[model samples]
Target: MPPPRDTSVKSTVIPFDPAAPNARLRRLVHHDVLERWRAADRSAHAPRIVAVPGGDGDDWAAAALVTARPHTAYLKIVDAVGDVPTAVEAVVSHARDRGLAQVKWEGWTVNPEVAALGFVPLSVPLAQDAESSGPGAGHVRWLHDGEVTEPPYYGQTTHFTCGAVTALVAQAHAGELARESFDRRAELTLWRDATNFPACEPVGLGVAVRRAWPSSPVTVLLDTERPVLLDQYPQDEQEWRAVLQRASREEAGRIGVPIDSHPLSMTTVRSALGRREHVLLLVSLADMQGFDVPHWVLCHGAVPGALVIEDPWTHTAAGDTWVDAHLLPVPDLSLDAMSTISPDRIRGAVIIGRTEA
Candidate 1:
């Protein structure tokens, strides 16, 4: 709307000592974040590491290369030090120097922190003439003028937690990630391809498979509905409320906000091992019994104000269809199971900013 905040504005990366008195790079997120991306699949010749900067100013930041023609690259910055806005500018400059433009940018927060920092939402403004899908769309935002890379709420890659991983699968089938900035509707359902999905990601090297083919279906080891949401998002009511309000003007009640719109404080995003994941639909305690809970789904890269609640539970398991058809008399799941249980689930919803109506 506001002429799409100018992402073209560039800034130079300030060289700072990691041990300096007031440096921002030490708190940056890219160095460690690269490990997770690499862990996804390093052997694949297509994606490989290009740069990992050091020192305090370089914290929480990493540069990577996508092994494709034209040598596509990305700069991922999470929990960056100092002003995030400046870091984003530096990234743009760095990309330009590498003979590249634009970025497949991403961030994790209820507010459009990165967007405000010059990165654009891939879905909100929508890319007018960019290629719709395939390798082209994945890296299109970085190449075109006035292109914005707004990823759908669900398909966005969050921290490497079981909840984020499971929710990614759920969003895939539910159609949360398909809406691209361009008119093209990317196929998130491709993740459901058992044979095509990456197996090493879900199970790791402990369980070696017979053969790593392009079409082998490995049973998804991650539990699809284990209450892992809190692990992924982990933000409490206050933070969630603040972020939701900043992202959109939706009714707080719809997002489970209390009448006062205040929920208890939460610990850091990090949780202890063995904490169960949050799965299924989640609503704030305040909105559970509202007369009409509006469920909005993202279509064509925007939140279409439509209500579709055929099944009470937003997520249905592979066996759920059979169970609902034969074993259960009722079509909808009980509301108790759909509400948020932890920070990960609630936080993710707030960050993605969608209503399942």
Candidate 2:
């Protein structure tokens, strides 16, 4: 058999400090990329740098940048002068210590060493465009067994199409839409049908989904009566958007769609997922991406302490690929906090049930 894996090699974890520059880290990552990492560090999902010392103990033989969500840790960047296996081991150890369920590595390219360490390649559908494919391959290693079924991932081709992409993904998960049809054309078409100028309001998107697939049952939950996602627009623009939202709500009522005028609770969301229904949640990306912008995400499943979600938008600049966005795990507490929007604390969700035969 092959030589026993090295167990003696240990790694040191250092919190990334933008102010203090380390020669070892600089050698692995460029100055500009380091600045980007610093900005990400300031975000809620701050990353830490892990370094494994060389045999001579004078230089780092391997280094990796990593961050932890509620249930998983992402190996954002990795470089090894030698002993790639050791680097993987060090990162895995850190993830385990953090009480994470899995460790994800999105490599710039395929590396056999990572696969040798029991990291399985995540199934990514062929992208119609290069930007959706992202820059690299994604692999994940589970620390423990749990039910984490990932729905089909579809990256938004444009910035404003998250809502449409998420709605389509929810439909695909429910077998209402074909996975093959999840392309830019479908995305934009759905966006045009659902969007209130730029952003897709809850009622507008719900109405669009209901109209697109009549067999699929939809229920919209919103705690407010005011027009949402219009804060950035001026008075005249807001008025027209409000009128559209009002129209959408009226259409929803006429079509037998249940529009609940209350906040969406985690308990209710869990119940719906338990029934195999998908939830399109409106959340502020402040905690996840370090921004306060409202974004749409699809909730597909739930594990013991976390809920599984699919975020259509990926932070490509921070090395996030579809792996980071697909079936992402967020803690119950964190999801509840992020799902509550600001100013009015608006909580919105569109529950899409399985299509009827």
Candidate 3:
């Protein structure tokens, strides 16, 4: 089993030091947390905790760190703040640039400043009545700083978790945690046959995994279109299996069979693969729920070799922009956002498993 999660990781404190240079904020938080860890009667492995920051541009960056896992952290900042309809969207766009999954704000009040930013006031503790003296109250007070733009603009605070955040942070890291749970050498892979891959008309992502990495299988955790496009093309269960079998036959490793019909549980998929194969391709996506899949595809994990792509016909302005930024030329490819060892490698997004630093 992985080593026990040291709760001491939670005790580390990241302070909001306004005097520090914009680029130096991350280092300052790291030093402060490390100092706290050293002073306590705790093991050296204790995770570091940094308080989320508020502001705009470099001065307004929020702080968070991966206490349990080194080389992991989440940061956010306000891009713009105004009382316009698109104000919140601006902040959301900022978070998205860093690949953060959620935008959190104290939505209970009607601060047009907050309202414009699209902050709908989450029911999080200390979320209401920013002045309330309660547990987690400090976080509430920190939200109201000049860094937020005026009028139609608002901002979201970033939080780091050794475990999970309800939204932005959680959405990005879930896949990392899922992948980390397995023994890498076990040769696990996440597989999704065309039947489970997402599509309005059953289009598989054109990319194919090289045959050698089966032990480190990709996890196909998606909310998918069901009954599968294959059901429409193939006549029977045998034919369905034949289609996938035919596709994977020439590959070096054996493709894992239907470990689960339920499609949501990778654990069930794991059970199905007990000794037969060491990979999992858990499928799930919004296309099945009768909704356009792209908006909620964030609900899915971006696993390496875990083939999840938007239906070609479903593309939109934002989706197209995303594809252009990441895979403009094609679909279903993975690239490391960070190419070297530095915080800037992760400067924009709260990503896990994308860095070796």
Candidate 4:
């Protein structure tokens, strides 16, 4: 059995000096908590760390670590200031500053106040829970049948690289990324090979997969009809979505992945899985926590009515929790809502096929 969590943290509030370096922020929060945050910084997908000063004394008070996701920033509270209510206040305030959309901390099970703070438990969603209009089951039970997993879980170095990371995981699933560890070096290599510099388009991800794993092939699927939300461009809103899609197609073809002028849908995803091929799909974070940016995930199996997803970014601590949501089933209903390309809502996907042994 595991040991109980420490709840004896107590500190006096102290004002922060702007002139001071970030190293000083560590002295303000719990040493134990800061220690863990330090460890997280070593990873490629580490959070952007910061601290909110405590008042009056030298005691380190409130601290949080933030990371940018699809369309919003994710804030995770590391050290609480006081009782549950007070501690929650510290978190909410910091998140508010960044216009944060999703909030999760470690201690939700013990304190109901965390819920009262408009925060929810980072529950691992299952496929069986969501109602679907498609097949029989709603989760990816077949992933556990010994056909899916291979290279295993490795967190992304940057939030924008989820597509690249997903591609790597997909390659691993196809036995193309054979290695002892898909560590920071491997992740950066994929990112370097894939990134469209400013935007993370699907084609860039497909391109990276092909460059890194020659044995396995990926198809970059795009809608032949152009998206109409052209006006929404450059606002960090919808304009870039169209830009990336066009660029992804052009670049995907340039990189040699079978670029398809066909639209993507649940049928496309299912067809790939049926052929024992892995899919790297783009989705919106808004449907889950109200952010509207393109995100990528690996889809390996399906339940009766839903697709099984293994997200690159989960609530796991660094390497502590690698494979999250083995049973993470995305019902057809919720899946469609999130998988559609922004503004245009056109479906897009990059299906990774088996390795040539």
Top candidate, metric lDDT: 2
Query: Which ranges of candidate 3 are over 4 A from the true structure?
Result: 1-101, 104-228, 234-263, 266-314, 317-320, 323-357
lDDT of 1: 0.27
Over 4 Å off, model 1: 1-70, 73-82, 124-357
Candidate 2 vs. true structure, TM-score = 0.85
What's the ranking of the predictions by TM-score, best on top? 2, 4, 1, 3
Pick by lDDT: 1 or 2, better one: 2
Candidate 4, residues 89-162, lDDT tens digits: the string is 55455444544322445441255455445443342221111211111111111211233233355456566567
lDDT of 1 by residue, 241-270 (tens): 344333322332233332212221111101
Which prediction has the highest TM-score against the true structure? 2
TM-score of each: 0.26, 0.85, 0.24, 0.53
Question: Whole-model Cα lDDT per candidate?
Answer: 0.27, 0.75, 0.24, 0.54
Query: 166-248 in candidate 2: lDDT tens per residue?
Result: 89888877777787787888899999999998899899999999999999999999998888888878899999989999999
Superposition error at 343 for model 1 (Å): 51
- What is residue 284's positional error in candidate 2, in angstroms? 0.8
Q: Is candidate 2 or 4 superior in TM-score?
A: 2
> Model 4, 172: alpha-carbon shift in Å?
1.5
lDDT of 3 by residue, 9-103 (tens): 11113432333323534443455443432332212122222333334333323333211111111122211122223333333433335343233
